[model samples]
Target chain A: MSDRQLADWRNHALNLESEVNKVVVGQQTPIRLITTSIFARGHVLLEGDVGVGKTTLLRAFTRGIGGGYQRIEGTIDLMPNDLVYHTYLGEDGKPHVSAGPLLMSGENLSVFFFNEINRARPQVHSLLLRVMAERSLSAFNSEHYFPHMIVFADRNQVEKEETFEIPSAARDRFMMEIPIVVPNDDAIMEALVFDTKFHNVDALVNTVQPDVLQFDQLNAFSNVIQSSVEASDTLKKYALNLWKATKAPLDYGVKVSGVDMNRLVLSGASPRGMSMMLRAARVNAWLNERTAVLPEDIHAVFHSTVAHRLVFSPVYEMRRTEIAREMLQGIVNAVAAP
Target chain B: MKTMIRIFYLLLGLNVAPQTAFAIDSQNLPDVPPGIVTIRTIDPVKLVGYTVGDIIEREVILTIKAPYKLIETSLPITGYEKRYKGQVIGIELKSVSHTKKENKDSATFDIKLAYQIFTNNVVAKNAALGPEYLNLINTKDSKDLVKYRIPNLDIAISPIAIFGQVKIENNMSPLRGPLLLSNVKENKWLKVSIGFLALSLLGLLYILGQRAWLPRMGGTFAKTHRKLRKLPQSPEGLKLGVAAVHESLNTTASMSVFSNNLGIFLAQKPNFSPMATELQQFFSLSRQVYFEPNAAHGLGTNPQQWLQSFVRRCRDCERGLTPETSTQKSGS
Candidate 1:
């Protein structure tokens, strides 16, 4: 694409963000990250409390993209085949088979939201991982492709009982794991509590303009964005150092209080994880209207892209959210950029 | 002969009165041969109020017949302590001098004596100059000799102060010691010490000063400017130069500072706040050089020169000085 065309698309992307911003109050960062993930052709994992507007934020984004939307509720008994097809009784009392939510959308699927994903069984997670990783599924003697689909899943970190934790390999397939929280702004909190406009979720989600971005062209524009945003040797080295720091934080002088540096990281971000990080950073640069990726671009997506991929020692896994935050901050602080 | 000797002594006293004002009467000379030592006179002037370190002068004169000449060896010597009743007193003869005049009938001798008081007394006491015995030998017969005795002169020797209350204003005398001591060398050393202290303080100020006028306080940005100046205009050189500046900003802020947090760095170090726009441009230039090397340089014909000037402005800000060209915009 020409520079002018790229600039126009960048404006459209920013417009999508503002459209979502209209509905979701005080979540500019997560909205921007989700927008970047859409442009990068990667899936996102949204984690927050039960009612911080996680689902609303994704719905608002899905409304803006506008191709096909599918929603699923993760339950304890949800099985792998439930995402593909289900059997129902016909009106004449005979059995009938119907394609499930995942296969019903087919190739037109643009946004797939799995709410409270941790509530699902590990077997369901294993099947969802294949769909997220390859954007395709093998079921019912056919291959199904969601070439335009971008999964946005949310799970509250408040509950532990009867919850099947997503394995590291499944988590690594996600490009970012962004956290949504209650807006600390007193005015926003008051609005959320008392404003009649915010009291209705469906009405609030309808406020965001639909079809602000072309879902069909997103994959192609992502390729253009990744190619146009140049990463010089110095930036590449900086990214490489960031990768090494995630692996061996002690070598980079990264220290987390009361955590042993030597045993903190059981495994670091994989090669695919690093590549996805670069992909997201390039999209961030494109969103910011830059022709080259700077260290700040990497920093904008560093924790979200790499933090989830880090497999911690089981001893420290209970405090993963807090420790991972401090560890990533330490890595960026300890490593210098050119 | 004794009466004639007495009359001659009176005549000699009359002659000595015109030559010396301190002449005193010499009477009742004992054990003196008649007509041999006919005339003699002694003067003890101002005999009262003598204290330690005070000098007393006595003048003596004698006329002896021609056959008997006064023996010079019998005169008192300097540093001779006087004795009273076989005990040595503190009074010592500090100096003595004599002159002789020869005449047809007899030889006249004039003698002067100075005695210094070395005694310490709590109260005023009577002190005296002890008498001296002089012998005259006859020239016609070496064995013939005569003795003449000079009477003692009694005087009062006082202490440095009286036993009662002494008032300085009333007792102001010309004989008092000086009040102020000599301090010429001490004054010279004090001036030198003050000069050295002032110089040391100035040196300390220079080392710890926040201004660029001082050598050591040129600061982090100044050092970075120097590093940039030495680099070439090549692509690698520009990259290295930008890294050097990034390093300096990080060191100044004590953390990594990118374009986004430049405001926080400025807020923490407000001296650099004036160059905020320029610093932002520099970060843009840094991004271009490090991340978009193939991209055209935005900083005019000579990027290295522009970088040098930009770093100089940053150096000025580091020194708490407002750069003259701070208003000038970077081409980037």
Candidate 2:
């Protein structure tokens, strides 16, 4: 691609991030990381308490991109077939095989949302993993494609009953797992609760122009972002070390208070997690107009890129967040300054 | 009448002269030989003596009772010089001393002498020919004995006398009397000094050998020398070293991951291309060793060597890419 075209593609990605920020208040960091992942052609997993605007933020992102969008609420009864099609009889007594939400949206579907993804059975998760990894699904003797698709998943943290935690294989497929918390500031919280527009997800999402870019152009745009972005040796080692630290925190000089490193870490991050982190960091650097990645870029996206990838010891499951924070701090400290 | 009176005065002067002559003659008698020297009458003789004055001089003479040929002779001495004027006075008398008790006969004479008392020079002008004297005394046959010219003088001799018969014997054996006499002449202090010098030379040789061999035996110094030799020489090598350290420090930051992606692109070893063979090898080794179980265990005793080799290859890969061009290449 021409340099101008690459530049325009980068500009468009940054514009999308800004556009999402307008509707999603006080979530610039997550928005940037999510945008980076999108441009890098990787999926994301969002975790938060209810009413954290997780769905709204994803909707804003999809609206800014302007392409076909699908949202599926995960339930224990949700089966692999449900994501593909439904065999039913119509009111006219005619048998029909109608495409499900995942397939009905067609090849142009740029954003696929699976709300409360952990609520879905492992069968559905397995299917989602395949779709996310390959960006294509086979059903009815045909291969359906979603070449430009970026899957945005949210897991409900408050409830665990009947919820099946997404297996590592499925989680690894995601480029990052971002946590959407209740805004800490009273003002932001107040604005979120009292603002009538914020109460209406559809209205807030509709504020941006839909179908702003052609679906076919996104792959080419993402490729340009990847090519135009540069990452230095310092940044690369920092990320890899962080990824390794998650698996073996003690080895990286990270010690969580009250948590025994030897007993608290079941395993470190998989190589796939590291690959995802670099992909996301590269896109973020490109958005920042930096030919080389800076330490700030890596630090800005570390938690989302690495936190969910950690497999904690069973004894430390109740304090995963505390352990993860300690682990991350240890990693940050263990990795030398660039 | 006047001539008769002058002759009477002359006769008186001559009578006084005769009394003066008699007094001079009484004081000029010859010295008698010591009775101990005359009593020791053996075929061969041995004697030991010491110096008694600032300068002692003696003349010895021997008169044989029979027409006998000169036989072997010797002077065995300790801490004494046999000197006449400025020269060593070697044995001149045949069969001067010999042993008779053990038919294996031998002879020895010891004379303990000192330098002139008033001089600062204490070293003897010449060494006594004691060994030659012992050789002559040990010879058995009288026909083979050599005679020595005798000089007579008023000699002061010790009362002790040593005498024996001449016979053949092993002069060098420690059991022999000659060996004891020679050992006395070699001072104990001199023997100790010679021993110390020999020991010091051996110690010096040992230190030199250690210096020459330790490096070849792979000591710590050798290992350090090898490391210094292998250090990078080029600007690219220096850049890579700095880069590796920087990356190692910033391990936790996301920038490192991003940089690695750029490194991968810059290294350009996708599908193991020929130009980036070393990079491909390094990547493959890291993956196998890090990701595959038991790979480290398989490394055996040479883990450091394997690790060092891996690090070096990675450095080589890193150095091949210029920082400015690497960014451009990765972006492309």
Candidate 3:
């Protein structure tokens, strides 16, 4: 694609963000990040509380970017087979088989939201991890490819009982783990409480214009953006240092109070995580109408892209949400850019 | 002839007794019994240049036999001048005191006498502390009075100046006003001390003050600019320059400084806020040099020069000075 065509698509991507913003109030950053993920062709993991509008935000995004959509509620007894297909009783008193949400959407599936993902069994998570990692699955003695699909999963942090924690390997497969926080502004809070439009989530999500971005063309355009956005040698070194800091923050002088930095990380961001970070940063740069990737671009996606991939020691894992946030902040604060 | 000369010497000794001997006439007074009184005197060391008001001190240690005690009233009184040939002399007894030590068989007296010169002359002249006659009474025989004498002290006195016209040519300058001390050296030292104090104050201002008028006022960025100036325009030199700036900003912010959290850095150290735009440009230039070396710097033809200028402005900002806004450019 030419620069002009990319510029045109950049406008469209921004338009899609504005359309989602129209329904999802005070979530501009996450919306921008989601837009970047779409163009980067990476899956997202939305984390939030029980009623902080995580589903509403994703639904609004699906509305703007028209494609096959699928929703599934994770449950304790959910089996891997439940995602492929399900067996049901027909009126003829015979067993009837129908494709499940994963296979029902087929290759055109672009947004697959698994709500309360932690409530699902590990077996279901394993199957989903394979699909998320390879974008292909094997079932029914055949193979299925979901080249255009991007998974969006959200789990409430308020609950932990009977919920299986997503393991490190599964978490690493995701391109980003975005935190969905309710807007803290008093006016926005007041609007959320009393605004009539915000009361009906379905109507609010439906308010977004549909199909502002062509979902099928996003893959090709993602490649174009990744190729066109130039990253300087200096930026590469900086990004390399950022990656190294995640692994060995002690060497970079990254310190968090009341935590031993040496034993903080069992593992750093993986190579794939760093690549996805750069890919998303490039999209961010392109979205900002720049040709070269700046450190600011990396920062825009740093915590979202890299924080989840860090495996803290089991001692710190209980406070992963707080410590991971501090560790990432300390990394950026300690590692100098060019 | 030898016997005649001996007789003359004996007569002279009789006329003027030895220094510590009694020199009183015994015609009208009963003489002290032989071995009854003995005197030893200590006088002033300087014997010449006795001008008016010069004091001569003499101490007499007298030992007298038992039953013969010194009558205190017989001691010489202050303000008394001795007579020689019925003429009052230039020396006056200023003070007299005595302390006594008594034993079973004998008693000793320690006498201290002070005399003052009351006269001067046009020429040097001889002077004397005249003799003192002290009486001793026998306690057993009240009617018997014995006289003991303290010999005179001999010294020379000189005038302060000659009596007649003195020539200025005789190694003497005309009398001038009271002496005034020269302060040329002191004045020179005072000026030097003031100069050093001013220099010390200026040095303190340069080191500790927040002004940019002096070198090293903004030490971090100033040092960075110095390093950048020496760097070549080569790719490696550019990286080194950018690294120098990064280190400087890190030190200024007291943490690793990147373009993203620059606002926080500025808020922490408001001294660098004026060059916020230039600082942003520096990060962009740094990124291009170290991270995006292939892309054109887009900071005019010589990006190294641009970096030097940018760091210079940052130095200004670090010094709490307003950065020159005219040089602001988009680093992209």
* Sort by lDDT, top down from the best: 3, 1, 2
Q: Model 1, residue A12: displacement in angstroms?
A: 1.6
Q: Per-residue lDDT for A1-338 in model 1, tens only?
A: 99998989989989998888878899999999999999999999999998899988999999999999998999999998898898999998999999898988889999989999999999989888889988999888889999999998988888988788989999998999999999999999998889998879999899988899999999999999999899988889999999998999999888999999999999999999999999999999888877888889999999999999999999999999999999998888777887
lDDT tens digits, residues B113-218, model 1?
A: 8889999786667778868777766788876656677667888886777767876566444444445688999999999999999999986675344456775366
TM-score of chain B of 1: 0.40
Write candidate 2's Cα lDDT for B136-164 as tens digits: 21133432333232222222232122224
Candidate with better DockQ, 1 vs 3: 1
- Please compute and give the TM-score of the first chain of candidate 3 against the native first chain: 0.98
TM-score, first chain, each model: 0.99, 0.94, 0.98
Off by over 4 Å in 2: B1-332
> What is residue B171's positional error in candidate 3, in angstroms?
24
Regions of candidate 1 where Cα sits further than 4 Å from its true position = B1-220, B233-235, B294-299, B316-329
Worst 10 residues of 3 chain A by lDDT: A329-338
Instruction: Compute the lDDT for candidate 1.
Output: 0.85
* Total backbone collisions for each predicted model: 0, 35, 7
